[model samples]
Target: MDGLIDRVETERKLRNVWHWLPDAVSEFPIETWAELNVTVADSNAPYRPVTRFESLLQKTTTVRYLRPEVALMEPCFDVLYRQVHDGVDVTLIDRPNCHTYFLSTYPERSSELLQQDNFTVLEHDELPPYGTGLLDERVTISCYEQESGTVQAVIDTDAPPVRGWAQSVYENYLSDARPIESRL
Candidate 1:
């Protein structure tokens, strides 16, 4: 056919709109979380570790932190390696520009694996506000942040599994606090 149909014209409009509203009040405070973006790598260090960790992190759903140095990421990688062997899928979502969310179904296993010198177990209230409904369907998930450039993991208190996993991991970490010095 010479022509399939009549010609059509389309118009597109872009608008910038702003709104004013009152603040919200809740029993729990709404916290803020900044995206983790580590764009700097140590110039003196070899490029392998930095790219290795960055590549590993990128294999997951999404990761905010990037270009972490060897020293900063080595320990985390070690723990992650052990965690993997222990049957916990640890995916790096963020690094210490602050926090790393290990995307796994076994939060307890991940927590136990991460209980080391650099890793700390955090409570739900202690965590910054993440996206709403992020954990609604998740029964067990592990998320961590850093203290003084080290890694830490947290269990979602609102999750039913947290009542058991979080408490046990917290106790375990407190009972045995030691630094792990090894590489994968």
Candidate 2:
């Protein structure tokens, strides 16, 4: 039976393909990062919960963040303040809007945040189209979909290519960014 043999061969190929697929069994979207002990730096959306970066700040020795929105930066101010006080190296790259928000709304606190020795604030006119951060060896990249107005983050700890790309993007931006004092 030629038809029967063909069916058997098809089934065998299907089984082989199934074995090659990854066995990911997690309910949360970014659970793989948690399993790998990778820190995720996600942007704060109005509808979503606070990002894990707040909790990771306690244990992270170094932090590099590119923040496009002032609202997203507000919640983590206190945590960053504490981390800088604890001698963590914190570098922030922000757009002009963030500086305006701080100077107009929270002048005193903003000054305190910028004046820390362990903290460095840089301003850029335009940044790469994504929000990205590095917490030690972990790299997180958030891209916004213009059509849907939705944001998604790709967090990786072990992938060399992803880490290299993130580092390259960060360094490129950092090179052209101006210090906050220069902007003042």
Model 2 per-residue lDDT tens digits across residues 95-131: 8766778777878877887788888888999875556
Segments of candidate 1 deviating more than 4 angstroms: 1-78, 95-156, 160-184
| lDDT of predicted model 1 | 0.28
Candidate 1 structure quality by residue, lDDT tens digits, 1-184: 2121111110000000001100111112222101111122234543433343434443433222212222444545654455445444332222232233332434465555565433332222222221111122221222212233322211122433333333343344334322221211
How many steric clashes between backbone atoms does each model show? 0, 0
Q: Candidate 1 has what TM-score?
A: 0.20
- Alpha carbon lDDT of residue 73, candidate 1? 45
Error of 2 at 71 (Å): 3.4
Candidate that scores best on TM-score: 2
